[model samples]
Target chain A: MSVHLLYAFAGAGVFTIGLFGMVFMVHLLRKLLAFNLMGSGTFLVLVGLAQHRNGVDPVPQALVLTGIVVAIAATALALVLIRRYFHLTGQVTLEPGSRDDEGHS
Target chain B: MTSWLLDGLVVFMLLATAVSVLASRSLFRAVVMFIAFGMLMALAWVRLQAPDIALAEAAIGAGLTGVLLLDAVAHFRRGPDKERGGAS
Candidate 1:
């Protein structure tokens, strides 16, 4: 269906943009946010593609529900770790001094 | 009919907000916009006819995530060490 196709395209775009942010951003929290975007995009694609002639599929819906719960828990743990790291090193990024070292080569 | 138009608009808003979240200069602003983006995404789920996902997105994506992001922002603003001139 055209509606399905449109949503799929939008999902793809969201995924691509999230990947860009995850790869380029220095801030760990931004990377986490981008990761969430990527998760939403994936959920969109899953739900979008599961539609059939009769009606919507329930399988993907259940899976995505699980994914959402898992994602939130993972994000919470990551945030705690990041906060601890910040307290220890006062650096938000994982690889601070190594970035320039990698760029030169 | 009009439903198709709504879908188009929802998708448009999702893309727009997603881009803004990535592009915003201030990390705080980006986090705030990301919360907006998450809620808009819940709208997109509604348009997709997945009320369950819409609810989940609103709760987890927007609500919990927003709370966690705001907490992190507070840490970012309140420097760990004022003498070191924390800017990271």
Candidate 2:
């Protein structure tokens, strides 16, 4: 197979692995890392697909650029919320089982 | 010829990074592995001829996100150091 196609397959494999980790990991930080890994894999696949064109695919590249910025903004906001939850509950909180504490406070 | 070999090598590194980021026990180690994964991902982007993505992945994927994660960890450590549902 061609190098670009091989790279695309590789990206897909990594994307699957990252997806598995995201769902299975218990820690909030690990979940965040896995999510980012999946994101990187998606970006790799997009860039790999762009390689098929004779020239740059400005569309995918621009979309991925916008995605990177949005990912950071979301991560920052999530981290802030994670910190706030930890401070209030005295625990490293995850998504589930934390709602009751919020209602009490 | 050599580019193919380099491509395979990078793919291996990518897989390894994924495994390490998940398998690591220490929270700090996992975060470091995640950063390394981001860097290797940038390399893959470079190899794929997307310099803009390489740049963004390096900056946002690795640089900015790393700061945010490390800050989160530090904030957690400064507190009571308890697990989510344990001992509280």
Candidate 3:
């Protein structure tokens, strides 16, 4: 198979793994990591698909660059939120078990 | 040819590390594996003919994310909140 074809399947596999982690992981940070993995998988597919007969199209490259910047900013914001949550509640995870506490309040 | 062989190896490494990252119990080990996964993904990007993505994956995905995770881990170890379940 060609390079694009190989990476396309790889991209799908990565995406699936990331999706599973995101759904099953309870930790906020792990979820964020999984989210990043998912995004990277999508980038791979986009770039892989952009390959034309002779060369790669530039649009997807530009989109990926934009995605990278966006991903970083999002990660920073997410980390900050996690820090804030810890500072406020002393909890690593916002467990559903804590809803009783919320209900009492 | 060497090209296909190398590509296969890279893909294998990428998927393997990804699985390890998810399966690892220790938060630190998982993060470390994640960084390695990102590097392998960067290599895959290069192989797929996307140098710009490779650069971004290395810098943003691997480098920045790794530092961020390490900071979180350090804070987790020493901070007042303490470790709860689901750290891994």
Candidate 4:
């Protein structure tokens, strides 16, 4: 297989892993990390698949560049929100009355 | 031959770091692994022949994001005490 296709498959694998983490993990910060991983994996698949077919296309590359910027902005906003949530609630996980919240309250 | 080997290695490292970022018990260690994952992703971008992405991934993805998350981790660790003090 071509190198780009290989990368695309790898991206799929990464995306699956991220999805698993996002679903199973209870911590907000961990969820954010998983979200970022999902974004990165999607970017990889976009560029990899496009390049595999079109031979070094600039369109997908440009798109991925903008995507990376947006992803960081989203992550920053999420972190701020998480900090605010923790500041008020003193708990990291989203679940109300979770085991982690027992001692804090 | 060498190129394939290098690409495979980078891909492996990328997935490995991604897994570790989620699997690690310590939040700080997870964030650190995420930073390492970002670096490996930059290298993967280079391998995929996207130098622009490689540069941005290294700078923003690895550098800026890493610092942002590290700060968040620290805040989360120490947040409850400060909150208690403020609340009372």
lDDT score of residue A95 within candidate 3:
90
- lDDT, candidate 3, A1-105, per-residue tens: 577777777888888889999998877777887888888778877877667334677778789889988988998899989978867776667795432111111
Question: lDDT rank, highest first?
Answer: 4, 1, 3, 2
Top candidate, metric lDDT: 4
Lowest-lDDT window of 10 residues in candidate 4 chain A? A96-105
Candidate 4 chain B weakest lDDT stretch, 10 residues? B79-88
Scored by CA lDDT, what does every candidate get?
0.81, 0.75, 0.78, 0.88
**Candidate 1 docking band:** medium
Ranking by TM-score: 4, 1, 3, 2
Model 3 alpha-carbon drift over 4 Å, by segment: A52-54, A97-105, B81-88
If scored against the real structure, what TM-score would every candidate get? Answer: 0.88, 0.84, 0.87, 0.93
C-alpha RMSD of each candidate structure in angstroms: 4.7, 5.6, 5.3, 3.0
Question: Which digits, one per residue and each the tens of the lDDT, describe model 1 over residues A7-92?
Answer: 87888889988999899987787898889889888988888877633357777888989999998999999999988887878777
Model 2 agreement with the true structure over A1-105: per-residue lDDT tens digits: 666666677878788888998888766767777887787778767766666644456788788889888878887887887677666766564655643112112
**Real contacts recovered, all predictions:** 0.63, 0.69, 0.46, 0.77
Q: Which of the two, 2 or 3, has more DockQ?
A: 2
Best by DockQ: 4
Model 3 agreement with the true structure over B60-80: per-residue lDDT tens digits: 878898898888766655553
Q: What DockQ, between 0 and 1, does each candidate earn?
A: 0.50, 0.48, 0.40, 0.63
